[model samples]
Target: MADAREPVVVIGLGRFGTALALELAERGHEVLAVDRSDARVQALSGQLTQVVAADSTDIDALRQLGVQDFYRAVVAIGSELEPSILTTSLLVELEIEDIWAKAVSDHHGRILRRIGAHHVVFPEHEMGERVAHLLSGQLLDYMPIDTDFALAKIRPPHSAVGVPLAESRLRSRHGVTAVAVKREDGSFTYAGQDTVLSHDDTILIVGREADIERLVTRS
Candidate 1:
């Protein structure tokens, strides 16, 4: 179910790379999935537009596969820093519109960025941070908008229940804005001055990271 217009090359056939390719294919993007293993290529044959058994680090092989014409190339060789780096460099040299690489460490991320990768992702580190936030109990979900800003889903504490948003003075006191509130009946309303917070209400707030954290931890 791929769209002919958005062609993408995914280099590497590890779980992460394969999952990404399949997801893109499902989203209607033409995907060429490359792997060094014949078995892997065979396994993904019907799942992708093209499943090729070739080393992504091989520039000649890449050109032969017409990788240069891909709208985006993902170098997702997990744990293999050398091949990952070399493949990233090759994709840049081929002038692929966008190059995304997976890095095992901060140092590796820096190297990939320096070599002209459009973006480098540290999946393991990011997953760990997300898990830590979930385990903190107060936050139902936490998403960092930037280094300083965040959006969070938090449950209102007992003291704040039955109070109008204006009376709570959350904006001035906690420096956070309650953008939405989920009611007991499963309906959601945009937070307004007249909106009354009730017990067990799930609220979505956006503000500075520190302020959001304070609001979540407020008693």
Candidate 2:
């Protein structure tokens, strides 16, 4: 659990916002949850540090709740573009340290960014991408290390089996570096020229997206 000093304000009382607030509270952050519905506020009152029934789009109401100085504020209003935009704009005007807003589409994300949201999250799209990757056999896992680089776990090709790292020329041909390898016997091997690929071995590779895809599809 995290320390309680970190403070967060969550706008909206929908499932997504409520879940985020609850998770932050569980991690020991002081969370202030706000919504326009009294029933929604009542439902989550005991689970958070503060739960208020007020329109987040109202700047005066937000100021009254001390939201101007929050460590971070999240706009989790789903499907409602008007409230989401208003809330994001209010957070920026308040000069909160960080602002995270959820967008249902790429167009919405662009609008949120234009309004000074520090981060725009597409939860539904990202979740779909992860599920699609999991269903694809070649990729065991995929994680973006940076804008242009990725770290991936992949099964070795049949031709790579029994070949030493130096002779495979994976780095030269595929532009990827094997960081670690899990052998068939369950022993792990860090990157070394002497290491030989074994059948059923899972290798961790770091490289650009296209190169990683080429390595995964290589025969």
- Per TM-score, the best of the predicted structures is 1
TM-score of 2: 0.80
By TM-score, how accurate is candidate 1?
0.86
lDDT, model 2, position 79: 89
lDDT of 2: 0.85
| Model 1 Cα lDDT, one tens digit per residue, 92-176 | 9998878899998999999999999998887787778767877988788987766678788888756557888888878888898
In model 2, the Cα lDDT at residue 44 comes to 85
What local distance difference test score does each model get?
0.86, 0.85
Model 2: lowest-lDDT 10 consecutive positions: 1-10
Residue 203 of model 2, lDDT score: 89
